[model samples]
Target: MSTTYHAAAVVGCRIPKSKIFLTEKVRECEHNIPESRIKDDEFCAKCGKPLWVTLHKTIPEYNRDMNTLCTFRVFDIEWEDFITVAGPGAVSEVANDCEKPSQLIHLPASDVRKRMERGLEKIGLWDDNEFGIWAILWGS
Candidate 1:
C-alpha cells in the first residue's frame, strides 16, 4: 500500500488586535518565541497580542450516516482564516501541550513546505467527497 496523508481541519478565527500586556514570563532575546513558536499563554512581541487567546471546541462528523469521536480546534485570523487538517502523527504536538505546531510558519504553504524536511502528501481536506466517504467508514 502507498503511504498517504490526510489533513485534519484547523479553523482559525480572526481576533481583534489590542494593546499588548507584557509580563515577566516572555522577554525579548531571552524567550524562545522564534524557536518554539508562541505558546497559547504567550503574548505577541510586535503588538504584545496573543496568538491564541480563546479556544472554541469543535466536533467533526463525516455525515449523518456515520458517527465520529473527534475534536478539532479552529482559528480565524487576518491574512488567512484557514487551517490544515494534519493527520495523526503529523501534528503530534497539538495533543501534547495545545501549542498545535511545535514549530510554526505563518507563511504560505509552498514556503512552509520548502522549509519542512518531511514529505507532505495531499490526502485532501475534510469536505472532499472521497475523503468524506473514507472517513465515514474508517474514521477514528
Candidate 2:
C-alpha cells in the first residue's frame, strides 16, 4: 500500500551459473503457494524447482545503523550482469560506510550501456532510446 524510491544501476558482470537458483512462479504454481510457504528442501510440484531463492546478501551490522543504507544486487542471467535494483543510491556509498573492509567494482556508464543494449536486443526490444527501457532498467 506504500511506495518508496531509490537510486539503482545495472552492472555488467559474469556470474557462474552454478551459483544461480530457480524458483516457482508465485501464486500461479500448482500448489497455489507463495514464496514464504516454500521450504529450502521443497520444490515446485509442477516444475520441481525451488519456490524461491535468496540472491541478495545483507550485512547484519548495517541493520543497526539508522544512517546507513543497504543495497541489493540482483543477477540478471539473461543480461549476464548484476542489477542494483533497490536500496541505497549507490553500492559505493554502502561500501564506504562499512566498518569492515570492503571492495567496490565501479564500471563506467558507457560500458554498462553497451551490455544493456545487448540485453534489450536479446529480448527483441532493440530501441536503446526508448524511455520505457531506461525507466525499467534504471528503476525510475
Candidate 3:
C-alpha cells in the first residue's frame, strides 16, 4: 500500500457570523456600513488579541436572503483551483466568497470570548462548558 498526500493554503475561522436585521436598530457608528459588508469583531482566538473587525460580504448565494448566522468554522481556500486534490468537507473559498475583514478595532480574547461564546450558545453551536476555550488552545 502507498500513502497519498494533500497540501493547501487556507485561512480558517470558526468565526462568528451574525445578521444585522433591518428591524434591529443600527448602532450610530455602524449606520454607514453597507449591506455588502459585514462589520464583525476579529480577535485572536488565542492569547486574547484583537486582530480586526468587519469584512466584505460576498455575493449571496441567494438574493433576498435576510438572516445570516453561521455556527462552524470555515476554511477559505480557492476550491475552484484546489478541488482536485483537496479533501472532502473542506472549503475552497468562504461560504459566500467573502473577503478579509477590516483591521480597525482591536480587542483581546478576554473581551471577545464572552460575547462570541454567548452568541454561539444561543445558536446551539457551543455549550456552556466551552466558554473560554479559545484562551487555552493554539499558539502565537
Candidate 4:
C-alpha cells in the first residue's frame, strides 16, 4: 500500500483580543487625601526599597458613547496610600463609591489589555513584547 502526506497552512497567530478603551476627559477624584503618611519604614513590593510620601493625578483618554456614557474621577495614589493594595477590583470599587450619580462602570480585563495596546501603538511600540509594554505603562 502507498501512503500520502498532507500539510496544513497557518493563517494567523493567536493573541488575546485587545479591548482597552481610552478617555480624554479623565478627571481626578476629589476624595480627600490624608496628610503625608508614607515613611522610610515602608518597602516597595518589587524592590523592597524605601518609599517616600507622594501622590499624583492623571487623566487617561477614553472613548464611549457620549449620550450613554458618564464621567468619573479616579485617584491613583502611591502604593502607600492604600491599605489593602490597589488592583483592578480595588480601583473599580473606589470609582463606584465616588462615581457620578453613584454609578460607575467597571472596565473588563480584556478591555484593559486592549487599551494598553492602543497606548503602546500611539508611541510606535505596538509590536513589542508584553513585558516591555507593561513596563512602559507601570513606569508612566
Candidate 5:
C-alpha cells in the first residue's frame, strides 16, 4: 500500500492544537500581517508554557438508505505555510523555538466521515442525496 498525504480544509471554525503554536509564530515574522496566522499566543491556555493550535474542517451530512450523505463543505480560515509561534521571551530566545513540524493525525475514514456529516447537520448543510467523503490535510 502506498501512503499518501491529504490536505484538510478549515471548515466552519478552526482551533490550534497548542503543541505547535510557537512554531507558527516564527513563520509569521516573514509575513507582513502576522495576526492572520497567529490564532492566539504561544502560551497554553491551561498551562502557561506554550501551546499549539489545531485547525479542523467541518462538513455537513445527512442519512439516506442507511447511509450518510454530505450536503455542503464549509471552508474556514486558511493557515499559511508556517506552523507555530514563540511564547513569552526575547526574540533571540524565542527564535529557536519556532519550527514548522508536520503532524500525522490518523483519523479513520469512518470517523472522519461521521464528523463531517455531523458538522454539516449542525450547519444545516446535510444532504441525503449526496455521497462520498473528502479528505482534508492541514497547511496544504
Candidate 6:
C-alpha cells in the first residue's frame, strides 16, 4: 500500500496542558476580533496570551484524500531549531537525516476517531471539536 507522510506545526502557548483554554468563538474575547484574525502572533481571545504562528502549505500535486494511508511523528524541538530549518526543503532534510529514527507511528483510518477521542479524554479535553482539541494539545 502506498502511504503519504505529513507534518503540522501546532502553534500555541507554552502553558500547562490542564490549564490551557481553547474556544472557537473568537468574538467572545474582549477584543472582539473576528475568527479570520486568528493567525500567527495573534493573542488568545480567552486568555489574552500571544500565539506562535508559522506558515505551512501543501503542494497541490501531493494532496491526499481522507482515505489515504499516512504516517507521522511529532518532534518537540526548540523554536529556534525549527525556524532555522523551516521551509519546503525541510521535508527533504528530515528524510535524509540518518540520525533520526526510520520508524513512524501509523494509525488506521477506521480507528482514528476512536483513538483521538480516547486521547482527548485522557487529557481531560474530550468532546472538543477540531480547532479546540488541537489548540489544547499544542498549547500544553
Residue-level lDDT tens digits of model 1 in 1-140:
54333223321111122211112332433434664665444666666665444533332322113221122222222343332222222222233233343443244543333322121222112232211101100111
Tens-digit lDDT track for model 3 on 37-70? 4345333334344444345453232122432234
Error of 3 at 101 (Å): 9.5
RMSD after Cα superposition, model 2: 14.3
Residue-pair clashes per candidate: 13, 0, 5, 12, 30, 0
Residue range 1-140, candidate 4, lDDT tens digits:
64333221111111122222222432233333343533223544445544443433221332223311012122222342211111122132212223333122255545544554554456343442331111001112
TM-score of each: 0.17, 0.25, 0.24, 0.21, 0.23, 0.24
- In candidate 1, clashing pairs total 13
**Residue 54 in model 2: shift from native, Å?**
24
> TM-score of the candidate numbered 1?
0.17
Q: Where in model 6 is the C-alpha error above 4 Å?
A: 1-74, 80-94, 97-105, 131-140
Tens digits of per-residue lDDT for model 5 on 50-140?
4444443322222323222233223222553222111111011111224333333345545544665575456454444443332334332
User: Model 5: residues >4 Å from true position, as ranges?
Assistant: 1-101, 127-140
lDDT accuracy of residue 120 in candidate 1? 21
TM-score, predicted candidate 6 vs. hidden true structure: 0.24
> Alpha-carbon error at 4 in model 2, in Å?
18
The best candidate by lDDT is 2
For candidate 3, the 10 contiguous residues with the lowest summed lDDT are 80-89
Taken over the whole model, the C-alpha lDDT of each candidate is 0.29, 0.36, 0.32, 0.28, 0.33, 0.31
Clash tally for model 2: 0
**Between candidates 5 and 6, the TM-score winner:** 6
- Stretches of candidate 3 exceeding 4 Å from the true structure: 1-102, 127-140
